[model samples]
Target: MTDLIKIMQQRQSCRSFSEKPVEAEKIVSCINAACLAPSACNTQPYHFYIAHAPEAVAVAAEYCKGEKVNKWVGEAKAFVLITQEHAEIPAANSEARKRDYRQYDIGLMIENFCLEATELGLGTCILGVFNEEKLKANFRIPSPKSIALVIAIGYPADSEIRKKHRKPLEEMITYLR
Candidate 1:
């Protein structure tokens, strides 16, 4: 397999994290990679709110602890809150508001961020179940912007990499050719 494939395989939704804190430089590198991802009409239409401080992490963790499985998010040392923004497509004599691509663009960026994090020997978990109102209120996020996802980042408590359970390629792919 190629290096990218190996990195992809290594990326997983980490639920358990160590007490070790994630480095600021590494997080910035990951963000830089995320920014390289392609977006609709070249409009990134997203912003990342990073909380690496202990207090900020704790506050963000509380909002992410929505369901039972996510309770362990408190262990993560850092959190990246993704917010969706209005995409202004500059089109000449064309309608640009027919469809929304903000979610797709955000997903691509998140994947790039997570993949870079995995390559940097860090663990990440993309969380969709969070207290949006509380997070917005506490973080001072404007009412117009919506929270897209929350990413928990840190070193894994467990050293061993678990096998990924996924559908087979044959079942997951369909070819017209």
Candidate 2:
């Protein structure tokens, strides 16, 4: 149980990666874990595009490396593009609901990927500041599908997870009688 706690505590968004290449099996292992994340009504309305080769990864990174904030993306070894099947899932995208359950599902999936990556000694940085148009063009993403988030994964230059600060449980939660 301590090992799990350590992995949870140590997982951080890595901005820098080592020159050493990440094994394909490790990437697949993390993604396989991601595939098991729960979805809304079992819709599972999303897709993952993985870029592993240097040239392919670089191309994907270009879309996310917009300005100063996301410049760190260029250094990551791989980028996983998460796209939502919005048009196809019209029944779930109701504006009146004031909530996007699909987005919530996507978040769960991404977290699963991150946790698995951390467990396998890999690093991940989730990026949403990229140009969607460029992503669509670069990846040839079909219309009606939107790029929800991109995750950069690889071995970290510094394998240490920096200190994580969070509000105490009491501050963020309350029990009901």
Model 2: how far residue 82 lies from native, Å? 0.6
The pairs that clash in candidate 1 are none
TM-score of each: 0.95, 0.87
Report model 1's TM-score to 2 decimal places. 0.95
Compute the lDDT for candidate 1.
Answer: 0.92
Off by over 4 Å in 1: 93-96
Task: Find the candidate with the highest lDDT and give its number.
Answer: 1
Q: Write the per-residue lDDT of candidate 1 for residues 18-55, one digit (tens) a residue.
A: 87879999999999999999998889999989998888
**Model 1 residue 65 CA deviation in Å:** 0.3
Model 2 lowest lDDT segment of ten = 87-96
Candidate no. 2 TM-score = 0.87
State the lDDT of candidate 2 residue by residue for 70-153, as single tens digits: 887777888888898752445555662455588888988888889999988889988978888888887789867899998998
- RMSD (Å) of each candidate, 1 decimal: 1.4, 3.0
Q: Quote the lDDT for 91 in model 1.
A: 62
Distance (Å) between predicted and true CA of 94, model 1? 2.4
